[model samples]
Target: MSCDNCETALENLYLFLDEEIDHASIDEIQAHIDSCSSCLTAYDLERVVKALVSRSCAEKAPEPLRERVLYSIRTVQVQITENRGI
Candidate 1:
């Protein structure tokens, strides 16, 4: 079932999955899915990826690695501020 207007493209579909689309766009996508089998399949694949990312990031970061990364960012930020005399 193809959309009559073909308005729902994959990029907008990705934004919807990422919760970056506005409510009206979400409504539009829902309408598109109701009519377009191809876009619906694509949307399903994106949902699977979203769920997988949620699952994978559910685990805690290792302590040393987390601290090291945070420290590096802080170091860089402080250096930048010092350079700018801020």
Candidate 2:
């Protein structure tokens, strides 16, 4: 595959790894990764990183903490919107 095709494939590498895209796109990215060593290295790194993040985030937050964080975010959003006169 051409470098341009490899470039295009890398653009959606994460989606491919996550199985979030169409089969045709997955096939294209898979083919590109199989053929291009550089892209393959990048794909491997991205896959490893995603796996690490997923495992690290497997724990659920306590309900009270979660609610407080969401409340703080909403409060900030309201202040911002009010300042913007929206």
Candidate 3:
């Protein structure tokens, strides 16, 4: 498999990690990462960080905090509407 340049592969690294890129791009990035130790290390680090963040954010906020945030958002919307005369 032909290898992609480090810059291009790293540029799409986040998209690759998030699975947001097309299959062809994924293959290209994978090939680059496989052959390039620097990019492979970077990919591994980012993948771990992403996984950790995802896992950490998996917990739901407490019900009271959620309600308070929603209430604050509604209050802001109302104030904005009043100011705009909408």
Candidate that scores best on lDDT: 3
lDDT of 1 by residue, 1-86 (tens): 22343444555877888889799988887887777655665566557556655665987556775565556545544553444353
Q: How many backbone clashes does candidate 3 have?
A: 0
Q: Candidate 1 or 3, higher lDDT?
A: 3
Q: TM-scores across all candidates?
A: 0.57, 0.62, 0.62
lDDT for residue 49 in candidate 3, whole number 0-100:
57
| Reference-based TM-score, model 1 | 0.57
Instruction: Score residue 56 of candidate 2 by CA lDDT.
Output: 51
Residue 77 accuracy (lDDT) in model 2: 41
Q: Model 2, residue 24: what's the lDDT?
A: 92
List candidate 2 stretches off by more than 4 Å. Answer: 59-86
Q: Looking at candidate 2, what is the lDDT of residue 40?
A: 70
Of candidate 3, the 10-residue stretch with the lowest lDDT total is 77-86
Q: Under the 3 Å rule for N, CA and C atoms, how many clashes does model 1 have?
A: 0
lDDT against true structure, model 1: 0.62
> What does candidate 2 score on TM?
0.62
Candidate 3 global lDDT:
0.69
* RMSD list, candidates in order: 14.5, 12.4, 14.8
- The superposed Cα distance between candidate 3 and the true structure at residue 26, in angstroms, equals 0.5
How does candidate 3 fare on TM-score? Answer: 0.62
For residue 83, give model 2's deviation from the true position in Å.
48
